[model samples]
Target: MATSISPLEVADCEVLHAIEQQAHSHPWSLPTIQSCFGGLYHNIGLYEANEIVGFAIVQQVIDEATLMDICVSPACQGKGYGKQLLKQVLEQAQHRGVKIMMLEVRASNQAAIALYLKLGFTETYRREGYYPTESGREDAIMMELTLT
Candidate 1:
């Protein structure tokens, strides 16, 4: 029974950071995560009952939405939390009149790449050496989804 919580809550940071460290080998720093407040950033958490299960961080500029980060606790992966988080973002987009959704992912992350593709996102470009990896660097696959 995952639940959703406000990312702006101070206490929620610890839970978010914990899940982030558990989910990403190179997770975004707590400060970097905080910097997402766009003065209007839309970051959401997935919870069950009262436990934080996953999260999605995103921002918008006019009619476009750029997904900055996302993660689901390893223990809860494959439980639809990721999809739910993404759906929330899309709903936010629709509410804000966003026409396109965009994001970049490490080329090596086949599972996430497949998920994005399955969600109707199309590869539009790639940014080489966009992420640091055990193998040095990885390309960032740019993907976009049209809202209407």
Candidate 2:
């Protein structure tokens, strides 16, 4: 299937929120997602047949960028859409002259860690009990990819 990446618009908020709620155990609130617009944030959507299948939100400051949130629709998982979304975000960051990219993932998210590693990200630090979980809290693994 052919997929295209484009800047996320206000009209996409509801669809992206629905995807996020379906894709993650703890999804960002609609207001939080909406706040990604304007500012120094870049929000991109992966469209398949004019519908958003995946999305990413990145915040950039000077030469650095942070991958704040990324998700693929529940029905679209395991089909490389997440990777494509991340790739697009990386390309956008590089195009904007971002020198480094960083993100934090739940320590239990081995799949995401593996993907990041495969895409040239390195583990930089760990935050103990940074994420709330069903069983108390979970650690957060911090990773970074140097674009320069």
Candidate 3:
């Protein structure tokens, strides 16, 4: 199916939240997802036939942006939707004058790490035991992409 990227609307939160829950073992609360709708946050949704299949949330500060959260519905995973959403986020950040984009992924998320690396992001740091896991906690790998 052809997918298009667009700004996430308030009405889209419920579906996005549902997708998030299915996409992650520890999903953001609905309130947390709703909070990204305003302020310095940029939320974009990947729509297939007007239904959200993936989304990315980013926050900008000065010349830098943080990719706060990104996910593609489990049913829609591995079909390049994640990459497309990420590219849209990067383009939007660059258009907003952001010079760098940063994100943290669970150290065990090799798929995500590979994708980030494929998109020119380099490992910048690591936060030990930064994310909760079934076995207690997991490290977070911080990655950065210089856009300017």
Output the number of the TM-score-best candidate.
3
lDDT, candidate 2, at 51 = 89
Q: Number of backbone collisions per candidate, in order?
A: 5, 0, 0
Report the C-alpha lDDT of model 1 over 1-148, residue by residue, as the tens digit: 6367545454477777888899997988888776776545678888777787888877888888899888899999987778878888888778889899999999988989988998899999999998999769989999999997
Instruction: List lDDT for all candidates, in order.
Output: 0.83, 0.92, 0.93
Please identify which of the two predictions, 1 or 3, would achieve the higher lDDT against the true structure: 3
- What CA RMSD would you report for each candidate? 1.7, 0.9, 0.8
lDDT of 3 by residue, 1-148 (tens): 8989999877888998999999898899999988887778899999988888999999899999999999999989999999999999998898999999999999989999999999999999999999999889999999999996
Candidate 3 total steric clashes: 0
| Best-first order by TM-score | 3, 2, 1
Mark the regions of model 2 whose C-alpha exceeds 4 Å error after superposition: none
RMSD of 2: 0.9
Model 1: lDDT of residue 146: 98
